[model samples]
Target: MNMRNLIVFSLLSLFMGLFLVLAFSLAGSGGVPQSMGVNNSFGEIKIKRMVAPDFSLDLYDDREIRLSELRGNVVVLDFWSSWCSPCRKEAAVLAEVYLEYRDKGVVFLGISIWDRDEDALAHIEEFDVQYPSGPDSKGEILVEYGVTGIPEKVFIDQRGNKVRKFTGPSTKDELVAILDDMLGSGY
Candidate 1:
């Protein structure tokens, strides 16, 4: 083959070999680990891309959710508090967006910070929240995500990279558009 063709073929083979190695490494480990690779300049890639902080929390409904387990889909991590007025105001909007994107492989998770389970559940029921929500009983998730106040919205792309963080309240249109931009663009 010509020199140009030989170079292209060699690069393709090298990439395929890398892919095989990555796949086997993941399978042998049972699940994806945190902080896969770091370049120290361009940031790191974990679980095939940028790493989102992983955690397992018990939901109000007795179900459990681990952020790392929700790979291969867009993960929305919103830090909210039931006592925050802005959070109360955006409750309906959040529920609407959550229901709208429920079927499109988008996972919306609400982490109620600085709130008691009793109050959070009451607020959740008052808003008729359909998606499962849980209280950050230990505040570890809040510290990990660097949440400062209620109504903080974080968007994680399909590869687990935190793509956007919206502090304070957001309108329904604003959130829906973001979801569309991220999910529709196939990222």
Candidate 2:
């Protein structure tokens, strides 16, 4: 190869190697994949009961769950990762809420983005999470929902409307209040 051609080839190989390292690093970080287009800005809210985008995902327990199939029931989609500290805190609260309202016609599904299956599984077991959760292997749901960070939550009502959303970790009381209103627990 000519001197100029050799230099270009070497540079190209260096960039490719860097890209692979970054991809693999991110794949292990338990955060959302950067290619999925993050939108972590729920601070400037223009909330509405828009249709919750539908998706089908494979759960760790060998079950396939579909958002559209969950109509007529309240659905709470939690975007989280094992490596995130806040997500670890949220897991306990989520399990508490899930235990309380699961039988009351509410479904809580955890979507693990930018994560490996074993790490996600370890997180679930560590937190004693009783809810169904799994890896979003291709980040399809994250991109669809505009998720930009760990521990983000999207609440869908019985009619499949994306009625509300919460970014960051939420407390048990906060989640309970929302569920109570959605399910009309007292009425």
- Which candidate tops TM-score? 2
Report the lDDT of model 2 for residue 16: 100
**Clashing residue pairs in candidate 1 (N, C-alpha, C atoms within 3 angstroms):** none
Q: Could you tell me the lDDT of residue 17 within candidate 1? A: 100
Mind giving the per-residue lDDT tens digits that candidate 1 earns over 1-187?
Answer: 9999999999999999999888876674344321232111221122233477899989999999999888888888877777677777889999999999989989989888766678789999999888878988888998887665556778899888887777667788888888999988655
TM-score of each: 0.72, 0.78
The Cα local distance difference test for each model comes to 0.78, 0.82
Candidate 2 lDDT score at position 98: 95
Clashes of 2: 0
Write the residue-wise lDDT of candidate 2 on 1-187 in tens digits: 9999999999999999999987886684455454332334433234676898888989999999999999988999998887676777778889888999989999999999877788889998988888888889987888888777767888888989887888778888888888999898332
Candidate 2: stretches off by over 4 Å? 1-45, 185-187
- Give the C-alpha lDDT of model 1: 0.78
